[model samples]
Target: MNDFYSVTAQPSRPMGGRRGVFRPGHVQLPVSGVTPNVETHVAIAGDWHSSGYWARQALKMLQEQAPGVRTLLHLGDFNLTANVPWSAYRRNVVEAMTASGLERIFVTPGNHDDWGQLGPRFQAHPNEPYRLPKTQTIAFLPRGYRFTVGGRTFLSLGGAASPDQGKRIEGKDWWRTEEPAEADAARALAGGSADVMLTHEAISGGSRLVDDVIARPNHRLFDERGLDASRRSRAIVTDVWTQLSPARLFHGHMHVRAEGHHSAGRSVYSLAANNSPGNIGVLDLRDLTWAWLD
Candidate 1:
């Protein structure tokens, strides 16, 4: 296939940034003795239905195609409806990751993670704090987080706000507040020299922003509110890009596989959703290769 995607992390002139090991706990027993300079393979997927069928399939594919992968990440949108049982879905995800022999698995929240209505009953559990390691602060925010794997760093950003949520916040808006969160995140990434950015929603500015792509359906939240979610989501995205300018930004939500290079005067990979077999995202590290199973 002519549509192959691969990007490598090249060390920029060493700027003397603090280095730290990832200590986040995983459902699959504790991991000890992580070596530096070791290549890490990671599998990322998101926007799963509440039934967890897609998550299960993605893990199965990872096991078969990217065996020996050290970590897996689910960006968000794990439930089909907010009313679905998270314990059941989490159990499914953890079981699959452990069965695949992955060292760790990380997850971020999506709009559907909310407790009522179309959202899932997802609150930060003591067992799972919805947090990941950062090169800077140890404090974790529910909005977003970061982690490193395969000798590269990844920043995961949350999605846009819905109209209902907006009304509750009064004058608060998603694009405005989310921009700061994303900007601060980018500063952290820049400070850490992060190599990649991952989010549940696509970044609309750079190559991730597609032409003629209807970011939201007519009757959906975006349409009813006149907010192009994909474009609005980009406010945070471009903010990060303007700062860290990571080598890649992998995202899910469109449910279609997309690949494009951003002309941000630098190489920034914009990866689309890998929600299907044909549209999977493939990344080849020096030692280990991972395919983002849809």
Candidate 2:
């Protein structure tokens, strides 16, 4: 098993000054032995919930804890509400990345991010690729979208069925499109194999490490019980895993930290929200080994 260490560290500069609510201090994990041959040091995080405070803190933590990271991948649920202004979301995310010294950021939309409000802003134009604002070095990936970086092929599939949909105001807080369509799953599997796969929901048959971690007292919010919705969501993710057979699969939305190997030989990891300490997952593409970082 890999050992973990926490050391006091500071950012290259002050992060957003003291006003920044999420101030990170004294947490660092060395990647010396784990990443020797790794072509990419990707930092994975999830469920920011649009809290600028946590976003700043999480990015700062990632910078200080895992240096030399090449890409920042946010699994999903980036905003608190789907109705948040696109411009505001863009600005906050850009500032955080700038402070963290990140040049490239890729995001997938979670249920909270898919509220009907974001559909028009992120909808793809005919024949043109969907992309986020250029001012911010961020790109939003649609379900089944695939891209490559650092010689690793990564596929992105985003969406989840919200258990609390009944409580949310239709068109403003919840959207039917929050779940993946059959076509989206088909498109995701069209590509032969992926070095890495990213989603907001976990596959069906992985070890119950994630469920076990989140089912603890006071953590019941992570567990939802709509059988039909659960099955649909799991089916899509399971199908994708079976088809692409990625070497590593990463997901968020459960808001817990856990890792386990799937039956298909893929290593699956679930990350906690940015608001929680030690919520980052660092993956070394060279060997597909990973560890949690604050």
Candidate 3:
């Protein structure tokens, strides 16, 4: 299938996404079936493993791709902000973004991040999104955190299963808190339908492109226990998905750019990894129109 969508041509078919919820580039709305013409836009980013150089490059790309973008919604894999080197680079995250003409960057914590520090912060501000340093331009969106931007409401849930779980040390590199808990799903469901959903783990029931990427042999984990745990993490997202039913869901982790619309008119866009093509996209939240560069 063509990954590129034409501004003039029509979205031809249903690509079969997320059991029954999301779809591809050409989205079909639930009520009007026509895409809106809203102006509020945000830079949508994929995972940034933990490189200061890549971080700056990603921001530079965002500035060029969607100039004047005031905010950036990073899908996950921002890395260990609580640790050294990582912390040093993070302190510069806001400065780089501000130079790129962006105001803020919010992360949905990814598996590669240091949840040892983030988990406690979540407990302290369980109901809201809080700045990482209260003075930094970076903020963490707690699980089940809901907010509105550009007249559209959003739900942010960050966490994913690391295929390399058995390859990393706990408390030092990998934190057990990187996976979403049952409580997180419960809280996310007790809210109104979201106009847009941002998550670190892609919902796994189905989505041809996403499923195909997930099935790749390179991503397989020999750690059966870790694989099982990964499935459990996905289950939580799926369960929350069935209830909230957001019109659009954007996620990263698969590290492949994939889009497919659900039969019900909603859609899903899985972003690529940092330093890769399709790693970033510019989304106009008002109308849900987005464009990503190669």
- The whole-model C-alpha lDDT of candidate 1 against the native structure comes to 0.46
Model 2 residue pairs with clashes: 8-26, 49-80, 278-294
Minimum summed lDDT over a 10-residue window in model 3 is located at 12-21
**Which 10 successive residues of model 1 have the least lDDT summed?**
132-141
Q: What lDDT tens digits, residue by residue, belong to model 3 across residues 1-294?
A: 122111222222211121222222221111122232222566788887776777788888766656646667889888866355766677567667767866667788788777887889788878655556644456778898876555567888899888678888888877788999999998888886888889999887446888876566354454776777778898898788778888888899888888878867888889989778888888765468678855
Ranking by lDDT: 3, 2, 1
Model 3 alpha-carbon drift over 4 Å, by segment:
1-39, 82-84, 217-221
TM-score for each candidate, following the candidate numbering: 0.63, 0.76, 0.82
Q: Pick the candidate with the highest lDDT.
A: 3
User: Model 2: how far is 169 from its true place, Å?
Assistant: 1.3
| Model 2 / residue 144 / CA error / Å | 0.8
lDDT of 1 by residue, 150-239 (tens): 455656665544433434442222223322244435444445545666665555554444433544344533344435434555566566
TM-score of 1: 0.63
lDDT of each: 0.46, 0.65, 0.72
